[model samples]
Every structure is written in C-alpha cells, then in structure tokens.
Target: MIRKIKLLLLLSVFAIGTAVADEGMWLPSLIHKLNINTMQQMGCELSADDIYSINHSSLKDAIVALDHGSCTAEVVSKDGLLLTNHHCGFGEIQQHSSVEHDYLEDGFWAMSREEELPNPGKTVTFLISVEDVTAKVLENVNDDMTEEERNKAVRKTLDQLTKEAKGDSHYEVYARDFFNSNQYFVFVTETFRDVRLVGAPPQALGKFGGDTDNWMWPRHTNDFSMFRIYCGPDGLPADYSKDNVPYQPKHSLPISLKGVKEGDFAMVFGYPGSTSRYKTSYGIDYTMKVTNTARVEVREKKLDIISEYMASSQKAKIQYASKHARSANYYKNAIGMNEALTKLKVIDQKKALEDEFTAWVNADQARKAKYGEALGLIENYYSDVENDKAREFMTEALLRGPEIFTFAYRVKPMVEMLKDPESNKDRIERYAEFLKIMADDFFKDYDASTDEKVSAALMKIYAQETKPALQPTCYQEIQKKYKGDYEKFAAQMFNKTVFDNKEEYLAFLDNPSPKVLEKDLAFQTAVQIYEKYNEIRNLVDARSDILEKGERLFVAGLMEMQPNKKFYPDANSTMRLTYGKVLDYDPRDGVTYKYYTTTDGYLEKEIPGDYEFNVPARMKELLLAKDFGQYADADGKLHACFITNNDITGGNSGSPVINGKGELIGVAFDGNWEAMSGDLAFEENLQRCINVDIRFVLWVIDVYAGADHLIDEMQIIR
Candidate 1:
C-alpha cells in the first residue's frame, strides 16, 4: 500500500507539469525557441534566414571581454580599438581631463594613432565558455543539512573550483545557479589587464540629453567611447606595458548600413544583469509600490538640493554631478517601474500565480506539513523588517558620513611618515594604495558646498534616529579638526610633491607609529559601524532564508502542478540571451514612435543657446551638408536604424547590436519607457531596447569629426 501511494504521488507531480506547459514564461530549450512563431505571439518576429545567417557569422567573431570595474567591452578593430558606453568609460575619460585640455567638455581625439591616451591599470575580459557543474558543486550538501550549512558548503566548493581553475592567469570563475537552484552553470572568463583610452566625445555629445531626456524615449544622445586592449609580445594578457601591442579578437562585428523598418526583426546578444519575475507577490508588490516610490522620493529631494547648490557655485556643480547622475538613474527606474507595473498588471498576475501555488502546496499532505510553518515565519519577518526599514537607512547614512574627511586626515600623516627613512615597508606600501585612491577622489570634480550639504543632512538624519550609545560626534569633530581649512588639507594630502615617490609611501604603512594609528581611527570606526550593520543584516537574512526556501518549494509545486511544461527562473545577474526583432510603437494617448529616428531629428531637437541640448557648430554643418555618403541605409535616408529583440538592462549599455549576418547595426543604450517593468516582469506587450545605429556612429566619425582614419578600419557593409 505504501509503495502504491509513492507511485501515485510521483504520477501526480508529473500530471501538474502538463498543465503549465503552454505558459510563455518557461525557459526555452534552444536559441530557435525564440523564433517568430513563439515570440511574435508576444509581439516579436524572427529575422529572415539571410539576416540570421549574416548575424551568426559576425557575432561568432566578436570576442566578449569584461572591462575594468565589472563592466564589459568589445574589441572592434585589429589595431586594438575598443568600444563601450561613455558612462562605462567615464572614469578613465575624466582622469585625462584638465583645465587646459578639458577633454570632458571638448572631447578628445587622437590626431594620429600614436597620440591615443593610455590609462594605467584598466583591463578587459573575454568569456570563453560555460559548463554545467551542479553535481560537483552540491555533492557535499545533503537534504538533512540546514540551509545555512548548505549555503556555506556550496560556497566553499565553488571557491575551491575557482582557485584550482584560475591557473597562473588572472581568470575568474563563477558558479551560477540556474532554474532557481535546481541546476547550475559555471562560467570561466579570461581577463586582460592592459587597457587604455583611445578617444571619447565631449559630454555635450556623449551625454547630450543629460537628466531631462535620460529615461525618456525619442532620445538623441550619442553615448559612445573608445578604448584599446594591450597585450604582451606573445599575445598573452599582461599588466600595463609600454611595449604591448593591441590584442586581436576572435570576432569583431562589421558595420552595417541597413536601416530597420516597422516590424523588422531585430535581436540583441549580451550579458543582462538581472530580472525578478519569479518573485513572490509579496516581494514584487513591495518593490513596485513601496520601494520604488520611496526611492523616487529620496532621489527627487536630493536632486532639488543638488540643483539649488550647483546654481550658486561652479565647484558645487562638478561635485554634485556624480550624485545627480546616481539619483537620476534611480529616479528614472522608479518612474519606469511604476508605469510598467500598471500597464502589465503585474501585481494581479503575481497574486494569481501565488494563489495557484498555495493551492497546490496545501493539497499535498507532506508539503502542507513541511512548508506550513515556514510560510508564517516568512510573513512575520517581512512585517518586522517593513517597520524598521527607515531605521535601517538612517543607520547606513551615519556609517558613510565621514568617508571623505577621514581620507583627507589619514593621507597627510601617511605621506609624512612615508618620507621618513625609518618608515616600515609594508606600512608604506599600504599607504601608497590609500594615496592612489585619494588621488582619484581629489581629481574628481567635487562641489564643496554640495558635499557639505549632504554631510550636514546625513548627520542630522543620524542624530535624529540613531541610538545615543551608537552615535559619534562626527560633525563636531570634523569642524574642530579642519577649522575651515579644507583646501589646505586637501592640497597637503593629494599633492604629489608631498608624497614623493611610491617607494616612500610603501615604507610608511610598514612601521606605522602611534600618531599614524590614531589617525587611522576613521578606518577603525568604519569597520566597527559596518560590523554592527552586518549583524543586523545577517539576522534579517536568516529570516529571509525561510522566505526563500518557501518560495522555492512553492515554485517547485507550481512546476509539478503543470506537466510537460518549462519555466525560466528569475535572472540573477548570470549570462542570458533574449531574442527579438526591431519594431515601432504606439504607447498611449496618441503617442506614435517610429522604429528609427534620423540625423534631422537630432538637429531639430537641439535648442539654440541651450548648453545641454545645443549641437556643436561643426556637427550641425556636417548634417546640413548631407554628407552621409557610404553610411546611408538601404532606403537612401542615411541608414541610422537597426532592430533586435535581445533582453537587456542598465549593464547592457554600449552592447553591440548585430544582424544575423554577423554585422554591427547599432549599440544598445536604453529600453523604451513602456518596458521599464521588464526588470521585474518581462511584458512582451511593451519591452523593447533602444539603440544608436552604427551608421549614425560612422556618420559622426566620418562627417562630423572627420576621423576618416578610424572609419577606414571598419568593415562597413551595405
């Protein structure tokens, strides 16, 4: 009788799979699963076979390389020309900017190949391949082990794998969970450490639209930057080398002059950062309603403060640029998410799915007994955290408040000690690293007034909410020590002359004196504050474990409830491929957008005398002269269009849009406003990415900038 019952239970699980088999949310088994028949029903089309043939040829040749700071770039030329988004290369570009050069304002051009600027310590990576290693990863974890134990064991196993596989190269290996931890895939990446800047457009061109048009559609932004990857004589990856040559790529997308039209098939291929469609209704609703709203409000308030301060001072404007950019991005995402949730009715769908899963779990006696208690635990914890969210934010603010001031104080003492002959080697070396970091910060366009305002506000927030025992008199201490002499302090700390050579600084960290240790209190304080937060965060995380486990079981039950069907798990920053074609839209309230815009639109959108929207005189002249030449599309309208149905997000900016023929068509920049909810739930009804046509890029190089030498290297096709 027991054996018969077990067989019946297994049969029931198989039965459920058949029910959900038809849902479009299932993970596709192959690339062809994204064809027109399947995707078109969701408003995407398959590219023609000829186009696919071409794109496959080109895409296979493009080498996927990771850039410095976890960003990605692609090598597009044999001479080591690299392409990435302006924002991705913003730091490097800013490093080269100065009062005389002002590269940020006027842009940079290599008058000749030899004149290209070189940046030290920047690197790029190439993704080799992926393999399934789930069995090896989870071999030590048994069903009897607690979730924490399982997690620790899995982490240790993956770390061992990475260490053993790393070899002598600077490669990185990631053990990624797939299908909600039911499976796993391991990725091995080869990284090159030598990368340098080649050229970049001025902020006016690269970030032309700025804050106003940032998240809005019908954009005319030209957000591109150039870099080069350097390698040793043996064609192996190397650190910064003056004698290095450009690393050759297995694939470089050819430039295409074919413009996209309405209903034309388009696809994008790149690493998308994340998505959260499989989340519980509780989580999804909270993000869409509570978190997003609060985030937008915070950013809006911050932006107002920044704008007010910047208007009165030039230094303030520069200092607040980074803050403004960060806030603007969040604000844009919040607004987009709100719009998408409403359009897709995501909350309702999530609730319905949850309800179905709940019914399934309750029907099974074993599942009911196991998850029944877990569900209550999850709910209780979520309620507690919801009440304490504001307190948590306040605590985080206090911990980060003294970051700048601490660096300023520590750098001076470290530099002085390093210059001494008796300085410890290890101590000096550590100080040198700190100095390098300080240099990066000092070079940044920082607005003193804005920083002061932010500091004041943060301190006030901390004072109001923090427990007295945990609070520090940071603001008072800062004022007392600096005594309105921040400029002198900054100069002493960052001036290269004071620090002398790197060797001297390395010695200071090794034989640190009492004074140096006392000065390092900021670092100590930071560590202590982080530890406190970590304790609280870990408690919350423990509670969240119950929620995750319950959700996973619910997902499994849902899967079992439907037979012969597949469902793709939520994205967790792993590599994924989404396919689609280019198409136009009629969003709402009589708003009609074409699949592609022309150079005329870019010029027409320019407001005369407006610093943000105004086009440079030279670019305007080129546009008026109709010097499109060979870059014009098939329609003779200057092929400034292409299409794709690739799934992407913020990290996907500057990703190449390749055709089936394996030719470059455009660069992915942003998603349409209607698809902002795509990060949470992909709605085939609205999600589409916007890209800058490669022809537009070519035209900018050939006509506007007269960079014919750069243009001659590309395999431009009609």
Candidate 2:
C-alpha cells in the first residue's frame, strides 16, 4: 500500500550527534548513540552502558517517575528507601498531619518499621525499558491526511502498540512523542503502589526559607523527604498491604559523603516534566504577554483569599498548606519568568532566528514549498493579542482560578451518569458512595467563605478585563440574578448549591435526578462556563492546528539549516539525562555567588521569631556542636546546599545529582532566580541548578532525626 511505502521512507534510524552543555534533555536510551562522546569528553567517567543499558541494570534503575511523573525520586537503599523533595511529598505529609500531630511544623521520623505511615494513593514507578516504535505509528500517517486524521492514525497505532507491548504483562506501556511528534518511542514501566513515608525533617529544616527562598540562589532549604516502597513476596508491584515486604530495587544509588566542588562533573538523572526550547515565538509571546500576566494576577488574588484564613486558623493552615504552596510556587515563578523574558530579550532572539529561517526557506523553491508559510502562519496567529488574552483570562479566571469550579465540573459527569435512562442501580450506588468520599475530601479542605471571596474577586476580573462577549454566561447571569454584585452572586450559589453543604450533598446522591441537578446553581454555572470555554477553545483550536504544523516544520527546518548544531528533543515528562558541572556564577553585575552554602549560612539566615526563618533548637545545637558526625564535607563543615550548572526544570526536583562514578552526591531541588527564563533560552553562565548537598540530607536523617535504622539501610560512601 501507499502507506507502507511512506512508512518505509520514514523508518530511518535516528543517530547520535553532538549537543550543547546548557540545553537538551537527552533520552537515556539514546545515550549510546547520541550523547556518550560529549558526556565523556566533559569529564563523565562512566560509559554509556552504565547510564542506560537495556539488557542490564544501569543507573536508570535507581531513578523513578513519582506519581505519573509530576516529580522524580531516587532509590537509595536495597529495601526500597526512596528520597525526593519535601514539597514533592508535602501532600502526603499534610495528609498525615493534624493539629494534634503537627508534622509540618515538627518533622516526622520513624524509629521502627511499625511507625512508618502508609500512603494509599502514592506510587513510585521504575523504567523497565524504552524502545522506538515510530515506524509502526506513522505507517498509517501520511502527508496528504488531515491533521485530525493523522492524529487518529497515530493514536490508534500507539494504543495498538501499547496493548501489544503490555499484553497481559504487569508492566505499563506508554507510546510518547518526541520533537513534536516527529519521532515516537515506547516506555515500559513497573509501578510499586505500596509506598510509605519513612522520615521527614520538620518544615523548619525541609522548607527553611519558605516562599521567599523557593527559586532564588544562595538558598538554604533542606528540601528533601524520605519514603519506602513495599512489594509482594515475589518482588512485584502491589497495593498497600500490611503483609507486603520491602522492595529490593534493581539498583540503588550509593550515597556519597564527599561533597561537590566547583567545576566538578555533575549529571542529573530524572523525569523532567516539560520544556519548550523549541516552542514557536507565538507561544513565547502569548505566554510572556497575556498568559503569564493573567496567571500572576489571578493567583495573587486567590492567594490573598486563602492566606487570610490560613493565617488565623491552625487547622485551615494544615488543610490548605499543600494547596497554597502549589499555587504560590508557579505564581512566583511566573512573576520572575515574565521579568527575565523581557530583560533577556528572548523575543528578539527568537525573531532573529525566525528571520534567518524565512530567508533560508525563500532561498530555494523546494525549501519554500516546504516551509514558506511557517513564519507567517505563526506571526499572524500571535498578532491577535487581545483575543488571545481574552481566551487565556477566561481559562485562568473562570475555568481554573476558582476552586468551586473544580467540584462543579466533576458534578457534570456524575449528573450525566444519573441521567442514563437504564442506569444500573448497583453502579449508581457505588458511584454515589464514591461521590460521598470525594465530598469528604473536598470539604475537609474547603472554606466556603474564603472560596466565595476568591470566586467573587476573580469573576470580577474575568468580567472587566475580557471582552463582554468573551465573558462566560455566569457573568450575565450575575447581572440578571444579583445586579452584578459578585459577593451576592457567590453567596447565593454557595447557599443554595448542594455542593457546599456535606450532608445535603450526600443525601441528594441517594436518589440523583437530572431534573433536580439541572436546576442546581453550581451545576448551571459549570455548564455556562464550559459552554463559553468551548466557544473560545474553538477559536483557539483552529489557529492552534496551523501553529502546531508550522512549529513542527520550523523545528525540522531549523535542524536542517544548521546541520552542525546538535539538536535534542524538548522535555516531555520522560526519563532524561542532562549533564553539566558544579559551578557558581556572577548573577548580576557586581555580585558573585559561591558554589555551595554551609550550615553557617543556615544559622546566619535564621530568625528566632520569624516563621519563614526560624531555626530549631536541635539544629542550632548541632551547628554549635561543630560536628556533623561522618556526614560533613572534606573541610569538616556541614554543607547544606550546593549549586550546579546542570540543565533541569520543574519535574527534575528530587532528581539524583550523580558524580563521575555514578554516586549520588546531591538532590537537584531549585534553579537560580537569575535564569527564570532558562526554559525559554538556556543562560549558560547565569542558569544554575540549586541542589541540597546529600551530606545535609544524611546528617538530618542519621544524626538530627536519629533514624539510624533508616541510615543503616543505605549504601553510604565515606
């Protein structure tokens, strides 16, 4: 068939070429073909086989994609001891904490196996294998097919391929796209579900500087947490079970007590969530202008609403801590990223690159035919900044900004199931029970007064800032229902909606009815917002299709134009290896930052009464004791944190920072404030990866927490 011939034409293997140090989230499996030489030449002592060999256990085995790849964790001991960032495990920690047991305020340490807490929904997945399945995926895809048809073909291939790959096997399979769907690969993974919390330093140590110190350099956050995995007696994945045994990992990284030095080879191995180095200039501007601004503004208002309640009540603080932290993180990141993008003139750079690309395309008939419309299509789509802003703010304000909308959206699905004419009673009852459980979790963290204030404020912004026509029908209903008084509107919705009152909410589930649900205020608001959401979405999706194809061709054309320049795919929440060095830099004109920070810096930043900077008594005593046991650096001082030039992003948090010999020396935690724009453009000198020196993590574990049984499990290096 014609499809078969097209598939054969595209079946050529991807070969390894050179790449830059500051960019690229390279696939581990392709290290043997693409990155091995550069990595070795840059002082990597290990061979490619040691990094990602499929036929043997390699460094990849020690790394795990935590909870569907939101973050990364590393195996540190044979008995499945896992180490990750405190914030990554903050949700679980918060789940276990209460007014009586304030673990967030005063950390948790398990002295015995019985003391460790089990997390029901928590899971850790290990990469079993990765193989390219691009040819099979694209066999049915052709240049003449519509984008939707092509997408369907690819999806079908992926589903079929995944089914075949996993066929009755315990392993889960994923067929992920690379380079904007230009290439494809299948990843097989084993997920261990019986994950338990082993130990964690109190918030004082784990989140030392709090929000003020999140993405900044010269940092002093003890941003690490500990957990353990349990599996069946046969060493396979299992759900939480009291009888399950500790999982013996395929490989566990050996902890190194010796700390990193400036210019030392540092390589981070983990699942980096995403990056857009190849994103079209349209995306960059859309984000930099309307999207980022909308995010920062709306989140600031949302934070104000939540923080008022969180500040006065201990229970609310514990309940909303994770939610607040998650929201505030990207809120701050957006603030800095907007500033960095403008200051760095990244837009200019992108425009220049596109300029050259246009000239290159127009220089030849064949190139013109292939890439002629790419730049114009991108530029023309992004030209409508007002409409883009309207679309973006509607999403930020109505769809995502308010918390109530979350439950409202979910209610729609349940309502649909209720409306099914021949709905099974048993199925409906089970669904009803599930809704009850969901309501419990929602109300446990819900404060209607706070959410009402937030919803009111954000809805005002949505109404005023966006075009009147672009505003959701809820806005018009607010006018007709409550004379545009947001507080009155929110009050009415919350007061009447079954969602706010728990008992009433669950009672309705006993005999769920479509007629009653349709009249529900919250459900009606969800319907109106979703309707408006789709209208704008249709407007965006039409342009997005053109942008997507243009971008795909732009990237391919860019690679061809500069054949000598090494190319790598963007990060897509898959396992990748990015290598660099432990080096400090001058972030601004006259100031220079050191490569590492010690416990001395920790004490200097501490304030007795300040919640963000308060130092604990034991921590001060240990520092004054002038001894770190065996966890101190070569200079006999305890290094709390260190800096690296390793390229990383959000999901790389808690990733293992390995030395030349494949030893875990630190955990990549944060990036410098100077390079908030690193994801858009890699700043070779200013962009630094902030990591917690493994020495600090171990010191807190073995000495501060006195969890020797946990420490004894690890293969510690002197």
Candidate 3:
C-alpha cells in the first residue's frame, strides 16, 4: 500500500513534470543559445531560429530588476499600464483607500484616464545588458585573502567599474554570478527611477483570504496591479518630474484574449529572487529540522503580540505593519519549508546523496583529507548561532519599532540645535538626522496610546533580555530624564501640541532651545546602547566566517559529487528563465486543482461575513451574468486563471506570464501549496506557479469596471 501510494504520488508529479524539479537549474538553451551582441541588436527579442545562436552579448539587454519586495514588474501596455502581482501592489491600493471609499471592500475603477491616481516615488529599472568585468573587479584581491580585504577589493573594483563604464550615463552597474563560481556577469542597467503608481485592486480582492488561504490551490485572488515608468524631457530617466513623459519600453506583452488550455507550453519572464536547494544535504536537513522550526516559533510569537496590539488600536496597526510584514513573511516561509521538506523527503534524499558523496571522497585520500572536517565545522557553527538568531530577530524588531519611535520624539529638539554651529554639526548631525526622520514618523497621524503600549512592551523585553551592565546605564538615563514615568515621558514627547500648531512645529526648528536639546541627549544615549547590541552581532558574524567558508566548501563538494547530474547553485536574486506548460494539480486527499479558474470562482469563494473573501455586489453581478464576452475561453468558461512551471518566489510576483510568441497571457502571482517550498527547494515533485489569467484582467477592465477606454489603449490580441 505504501509503495502504491508513493508510485501514485510520483505519477501525479510526473503529470505536472514541467512544474517539477530537474537535475540542475533548467536554463533552456533556446533563451541562452543566441549571442549577447545579436540579442542586444534585436532589442532582447528573438525569432525561434535566432534563439538558437544566443551568446554572452545576447544577454546585454536582458535586465535584472533587483531587491523588489515581492516581484518585479514589466510594462505591458503602451499607455503606461504596468503589470505586477496583485499582492505586490496591495499595499499601495490600501494606502489610497479610505473608510468612506472602501477600495479594499468594493474594488476600484478609473472611469477615465485622468482618474488614475499618481503614485509618488515609485520607480522601475531595466538592465540594458551585462559585460564580463571580473578582471576589472578582482584586480585588488588575491585568491587567498581575508574577508575584510576581499570585501574592500570587491568594493574598489565595483567603484572603478561604475566610474569607468558609466561615462556620464544614467545607468548603474552591478557584478553578478553565473554557473556558481565559474562565471561572472556585470550588468549595466538603465534605471527609470521615476516610477509612478497607476492602479491596483483592493486588498480584499487582491489578497483575499490573507495568510489562511496563502500557498493554497484553486485560489481566487485577483492579484494584479498597474504602474507607469516615467522619463525626462530628453526621454531619459530623471529624478521626480511632474512633466515627465511615460517611458517607452523596448518590449511590451500584448494582452491576449485567446486564453491558455491545459498542457499548453508557457513561460514566466522576470527576476526570481533567491533559493537554497543546492545546499549540502546537511545544510538542507539542518534548515528543515532546526532552523525552520525555530524561525516559525519566533514568528508565531511575534505575530501574536503584533495581532494583539494591532487589534486594539489603528496606531498599533500602522506601527506594526513593517514588523508584521516581516513576521508574516518568515512565518509563511517556515510553513512552506516544513511542508516542502516533508513532502520531498529532503532530509532522506540529502542523507542518501551525502552518503554516496562520502563514499566517493573517502576513496580519494587527498579529497577526503581536505573535506573531512568541513561538515563538522558547519554543524558546530549552525548550532552556535541557533539560539542567538531568534533573539537577534526579536531584538531588531523591538529596536526598529516602539524604541525607535520613543527616541525620535524625545530628541527632536537636538536635531534643530545642530544647525547652530559647524563644530557641533559633525557630532550632532547623525543624531539630528535620525531625530528629523523620527519626527516625520511621530507626527504622521499616529495613535499615541498604541505607540505607548508598544513602547512599554519593548522596554520590558529589553529589560528582560539585555545584559546587566548595559541595562543600568541605558534605562537609568531614560528614567532620570523622564522622571521615572514612561507614560508621562511618552505623553510629553509625542504630544501634537507642538506640531498641531504648524507655527510652533516650524518655530521649534528655528530656536536653539537648550531644554529641547537635553531631551535629545537622552534619546541619543538610548541609540548608543542599541549600537552596542549591533556591535555584538558584527562580532558574531566575524567569528562565523570560518563556518560559512566550510559550508560553502561543503556545497561545492556536493555539487562536484553530483558530476553527471547537472546541478545548479541556488538562485542569488538574478534574472532566470523557468519553462513549463499550463497544467492542473492534485495535491492530496482526493483534492484536485484545475490549471485554470474563471470569473465565476471569485463569486464561489465569496463569504458574506468574511471581509477577505467577500465579493462586491457589482463583481457578483458581472459574474452571474457570465459577461466574459471576448475574454471567454473556447469552452465558454470565462478565462480567469492559468498555471505555469516557473521557478519563482517573492520577487517574481509581478512577472509577465508569456507564451512562446512572447505575448502576455497572465500576471504571475502566487505558487501552489505543494510548491510553497520552492523557495527552499524547487521540488520537481509538486511546485507550480499561479497567475491571474490576462483574460480575467481584461474582463475586469472592460465588462466589470466599464473602463473600455483603458482597455482600448492596450495592444490586445484576440
């Protein structure tokens, strides 16, 4: 029976083989086959025949959009309509909403082009291409060098490369890696720093069901957003400009009314952030068994505290969003990691692979002697940092939140004092700068009571966790300055009395007030104590360098061990191509996930009382009428969703789901439940990428929202 179950599982996975793992990172020779120079000349697009000849020069125009929160977006519509995941744009949508006009509750419609709200300070960048500058980058560092020296060498090389290659152009250069340690790619990116928000669906529609429904299948979330990149008078990227024109992209995915069917070949194009599946079996096992569990525990605990406070006050909600977002991310990761590890039997497979490698190494005397102690060193280092990691997260959260808030309000006047004299400028500039930032935060319609509660809770945590020697100096100073009354101190510090009267807030800046500077000194002292904690972390990281090196060696050894089985190192926030076909999934326990869902699914998931899943009346009306029109699939089902075998994570959210024709079919969003572990391990066994079918996006614009004008601007292919 057990064997039968395993066989069934394997068969099910094979049915979705495109979504499953292969030996190494799957780079279709089709994309990389062409030479870099030809690709650049062709503007990053190629014919099937041309794809066969791709080379290093071909990659020059393929840009890497890095450090995006969830996923990067590409411009798809000529009229400045941007495509990105619904979740990535959720925050911006919610930010633009209010109680009176509950965009989150009912969704949004632009009505006309002018009605589109402008997003300030949002930017999208494109890498024009990359060049090999390894010799330029590594000129200062030898193979055998200290970490500090290596870091310095890398910095100098990057600085020189940027200085030389930039040549007065508005481009940023970055050094990247390929094929693990064997190759390097230097990307020169044309950064469109002036990106603006276009439109986004409300949170209820975009992030429907929240964490509970996250990573699950048969999902009904309409996770999509729109943004526009802007350029200056010269048609080049410039700083914020009200008169800036919309950027003209070299390529844009045309909206496809012809929807996908099961088994149809599809691909996702974008920058996928990071993954760790290529680590040693020992590392993977340790992460799954120990690191993931501890991480989950810490996040759950932190979430509990955040939820409690957020539920009580709106101020707490705003203050804790940054904290909550981080906690939720880790919590989600832990859950996904646990599921992936268990489903893949990652530990067992890792053990088997490790055993085979050990046998091979032991038979080779020289290699055996070199690598015998590597695993031990890794194990010892992981164990040492295990306890400290959790505390570090907790500590960082406390410092970032209420503690930072308290210090900011207390030291506002000292920031104003720094402008008094140049000599005092150097000493007080950093603190003054910090205080100004805090003032902006404190005065921003924050709930005083909730801030106080968070501050008090954090103080207690600090008291409990801080070393004895450090506590007295820090807390004593705070207590002495605030008269041993935290509540009173908070009340006086964050009071809007000074700021509510604009004249006073601005005037406070003019006066070189000694009384205000005293309070600032108190806060400065607290910041210093926080700095001490950071110093300790730096020390810990320094000591762990040896272990990190050993782990890297172990990883290298394992890769070498898998000689014939093409193995790729883990993703390091670079652009990658994942190819697969549209397909459905049968997760387990008789549950099956269809490859595509329709507009009707949104209504089906609607719960009248549940805010997250509750559908707006108009949305329900549109679905009930079956008004899909041109967007309807051939079978008459309104094409609302589809699936792909793309290996993606957070940063891949807003990626374009393209066909072989390079047309946009859907906007990439979440991955299936079985594939949540894709971040840790790309389980060829079950992971599948989920996307909002482009048909659904058009349907929402044309039929549901009645924004036919917006639809008309797009290059729609029926």
Model 3 score (lDDT): 0.59
**Cα RMSD for candidates in order:** 6.6, 3.2, 7.3
Candidate 1 lDDT over 1-718, as tens digits, reads 0011111122111111122211222222223333335544544433333222322333423544345224445567776677777766777776676656767667777767577777766767665555555668757776577777877887888788777767675667777765445455566666778777777777777877777777666777777888877789888888876788878776666676766656554455555566665566667666765567656654564567677876674445445555566567768888888977887777787777667757766888986765445345445546655423543444435443323443434554454555664645666666667667655445365544454555445545544444543444443444467553433333332332212233433454434454543454334334444545566565667576676565544555555555434355455544444556676666777876767777777787888756478888877887788767777766666544333445667656667775545566777777777778777666554556777777777777766667788877767777
Task: State the lDDT of candidate 2 residue by residue for 268-346, as single tens digits.
Answer: 9998887787766677888887878898988899888888889987898898898889989989999898888788888
Worst 10 residues of 2 by lDDT: 1-10
Off by over 4 Å in 1: 1-65, 68-70, 167-170, 288-294, 305-323, 366-377, 386-425, 428-437, 440-444, 461-531, 634-636, 639-645
TM-score of every model? 0.81, 0.95, 0.81
- Give a tens-digit lDDT track for model 3, residues 1-718: 0011111111111111132332123333324432223333423344533322223322212222523334677666554467676666555555555556656555666665456665544556665655655455545665377556666776777777767777787677676644323234466667666665666665656776667777666777777767666678788878766777877665566677778877666666667677765455656666676557655644565567667876774444545444466568657867877876787676676566567667877888877765666566666776665335434544543455454434444544465556565667664655545545545544553444555555554554555454544342546655678665655654554463343333454455544455554554335444555555566566567666666556545655554554333344355655555556777767877977778777677777788856358776777777888867788889887766677666677677777777656677888877777766666556664678888888877777677667687677788887
- Evaluated at residue 120, the lDDT of candidate 3 is 49
Report every candidate's CA lDDT: 0.59, 0.83, 0.59
Alpha-carbon runs more than 4 Å astray in model 3: 1-70, 100-102, 111-114, 133-155, 177-183, 281-329, 369-373, 400-445, 456-529
Question: Candidate 2 lDDT (Cα, whole model)?
Answer: 0.83
Better of 2 and 3 by lDDT: 2
